[model samples]
Target: MKDATQTIRRATFAYSQLYARTAAREIKHPVEGVVQGEIPRWLRGSFLVNGPGQASVGPDRYRHAFDGLALLREFILSDGRAWYRHRFLQSETFQRNHRDGRIVVSEFGTAASANPCGGVLQRFISHLSLVGDFTDNALVNVTPIGDQLCALTESPFLHRVDARTLDTMGRSDLRNVASLHTIAAHPHTYDGCTYLVGTRFTPPRPKYVILRFPKSEEMNGCKSFLESARVMAEVPMSSRLYPSYIHSFAITENWLVLLEQSLIINLPRLLLSKPMGAQGFVSCMKFDPERKTRFHIVDRKTGALHSANIETEPLFVFHHVNAFEQQGSQEVVIDVCAYVDDALIRSMYVYFDGWTPKTRFAQVRRFVLRLQPGRSSVSSQLIRPMRSFCEGGLRGDMPRINELFNGRPYRYAYLLSQADDHREDDIFLSKLDLDSGRWLRWHCADWVPSEPVMVPRPGSEAEDDGVLLSPLVHASDECRRALVVVDATTFRQLAFVEFFTDCAAPATFHGCFVQAP
Candidate 1:
């Protein structure tokens, strides 16, 4: 154990600053950037992203990176100039902690602080009441519903923030619209409505609910769009006591594609565990290798679920690139960043504590699901044979494609990729050719990149005719980060703008580029 511990410490010592705690600051006005190259004349929009900003309150800190508060950043580019700003989302939890100077709500991996004046028994009772009350720190992703931008997490609470000012306007609970205990953070906005998948933990009949929130025009005297939410379909739980942890799902023209993996949440353990310091909700999750992962596809027009049993090997997935139906067949194709197991979750805690597990690389795997009207069993396949991670191929995560081709057939995918030799920490922006199996990369030495967001050029029909937007941070410098614009066709850097700020600009998870008028 001693020798194994030493290996992990040495391997991850240099990357500790990636998760370092930092102060939050908001630039009220857009500051002009020092442009390194000519900005695209036609590029006009705001690139908005969200992630954890502050990780601690007073002297107590969150145990995991996901427990931090939400921070929203934006970069607007038009003509030949760019502007930038960032602000912290003032949720109920953020305001309560700021007003009281301590954490009073439980996050995903961090328990709330015990009351200072309460006795042991009193504090124990308080903790028991908060075991099921998760925090409202919607730090994962941002989505646009009508004219409002909604910040979301795995909790039932969603906060609406002003797009221009980045201020929290109000909050809405999905449980009011449906009997949902927790919701998947990644919701699909297609046609005129937003679709979400939520889980209800009602005993003896735990189920997953597919919800749809209508557009603002269709809402009838509703203050919030979620108030007019309606159920599209329902899927029964694979296991009565445990439901799989779903971060994101995908959609096609006629079906909602969801993967039920082996990583499960123990409902009894989570609801009964004492919510205290150092004992978080993430500890209650267990991955069972004996069970097979299953796929649940629901019809979009009708509220009917496919009865065919579709199962695959036991695996783990955080995000799905895209899912679409074949042009002229009864089949659907899903591309995702998949892992062999859930060991990557342990590597996240290694920075706070000196413990590491064997991690695997996230590969872009394509699964084909064949649907037949009369077939009893559905068939699925991993197009490529399982190979060693050390092989020279596409090893990356945060896969993205052009928004125009999101639910249809496409040819290109953008992602943050590891080096060819498969070094875990080394990363660069890469463009993948789905048909030719060719890979193109844009690398800046000693700098790491966040997820790549592809913005199509105005009036372009080609899938790869666009630019990739990614934020770059220096690996060694704590106060350095920049946004780089790369030509998607050439996969070369067009320009980069470094922002001036007092606080460090940390890495963000997922964001979208909205074109300005």
Candidate 2:
């Protein structure tokens, strides 16, 4: 038991620096980055990243690492020169909290003060109405919706921001176009059409609504794109009373792959819980190991759901690496970083003082679902089995791949990785060769890295002929961070622009590299 505790402590020690509370700062002016090596002249565009930045307000602090306000960071590479800037989103929740010197909005795991509710009765009434205001903290991801770059969260709210200025321009609600209560932050774009899945927790039965909108090549206003959104299909949940909590979904050329996992959201507990207690969104969720994780594939055009029973062991997943349809075969392949249960979510709560909880890791697994056209059951198998990193398995999360190969057959993937039972400095940036079943990793001692965003070189025929941009947070008192650029083909660091003092970048979740036209 002592050795097990030490292993946990060693693995989490350096990675824990990412959860530290960071002060929000807006570097409105773009500052030239001191290049350590020659940056690719072809690498021109902005590498935009977003995540929870400030986790505290006044004397109060959030209980979960995900409850921080949204902060946007941009690294512009152009003409063989690089520039950097950052800013916090000016959401209504942020404004209210900063103006009043207290938390005025409830977050994913942090409950606001009782003063905001005008007493306990109003809070109860608000929860019972099921129309309680959803938070607008778009701290999860940044992607383009039509011609506009927007920041998105699990809530129905998505904020449009100026990509060049990193300033919030406007906010739009998915509820305006559909009856969606929440949505997956990860949206897939293929063949000039963007696709997303939203869960509408309505009365008779909760349904997952698949939405699609055309990707506008020209600026058509912020709201015009979402207004173009139309419902493609709707799949009813396996259970009406308890709907699975979905963080992300997958897409193929002809179908949207939805996973009904075991992590359920109890409607009764969600609505009856008080808003000013230690309980947050996590407290209302329960994971059932007995339930099987089912897969429902919906046709992209016909809105027809495959009636075959496709299921696997109960698991929890937050992101889907990618999915592709097999050519000349009726099969869809999906790759995901999955855990045995929801223990990883509980490990992410922010603990005050010198206490740290045991951490849980994930393993990359692939599932191939064979469609039986006229049968009631579909055959599925775990093509890539789960094992510890020491056993040559891909243990990682926050995955990225070449955008050009999205919803299509692809080979390579990049992620922040770590060994299962290694020391504190075992974390690294890993490249998984899907075809070869091999792993290549890049490491820098004592510097925890974020997601690797692949930027494919223009006019390149090869899939990985580009660079990878990853933000690094140093686990030292020097107050330093860096943007490390690596050659995606060789999986080696080419150059890095280090930031120190006030310009240090905070830890980030997901980002994208938008090449300049």
Top-TM-score structure, candidate number:
1
Candidate 2 lDDT over residue span 1-517, tens digit each: 0211122232236344466557556788887777777689899999998888887888767777678888888888898778877899988888988887877677777766544536778756544443355778899999987777989988888899988688799888889878898899998887788888889999899999888886675324644786778888899998988999998998888888999999999877776655435356677788999988988888876778987778888999898889998844378888888888887788777654676655545787888877766567633432223333223754788989998898789998888886665553466788888877788787776566889999888898899999989987776642576788889999877777765547445578888888798
Candidates' lDDT values, in order?
Answer: 0.77, 0.78
- Candidate 1 C-alpha error for residue 458, in Å: 1.2
Off by over 4 Å in 2: 1-17, 116-131, 215-223, 275-278, 327-329, 378-391
Q: lDDT tens string, model 1, 1-517?
A: 0210021212332332455546456677887777887779889988888887787787667766677888888888988788888889899889887776877787777778777779998888778777677688898887786666889988888889888788889898888778788898888878877888988888786788899888888888987676888898989878988888888888888889888998888887887776434467788787889877888888876868876677887888888888898845368888888887877665555244464433344888787777765555744432323332223565787788997887788888898877446456656778888776678877765566888999999899899898999876667665677888999999877888877766776677788888887
* Highest lDDT scorer: 2
TM-score, predicted candidate 1 vs. hidden true structure: 0.92
Per-prediction TM-score: 0.92, 0.91
RMSD of every prediction: 4.9, 4.4
Residue 503, candidate 1: alpha-carbon lDDT? 71
Give per-residue lDDT, candidate 1, residue 399: 83
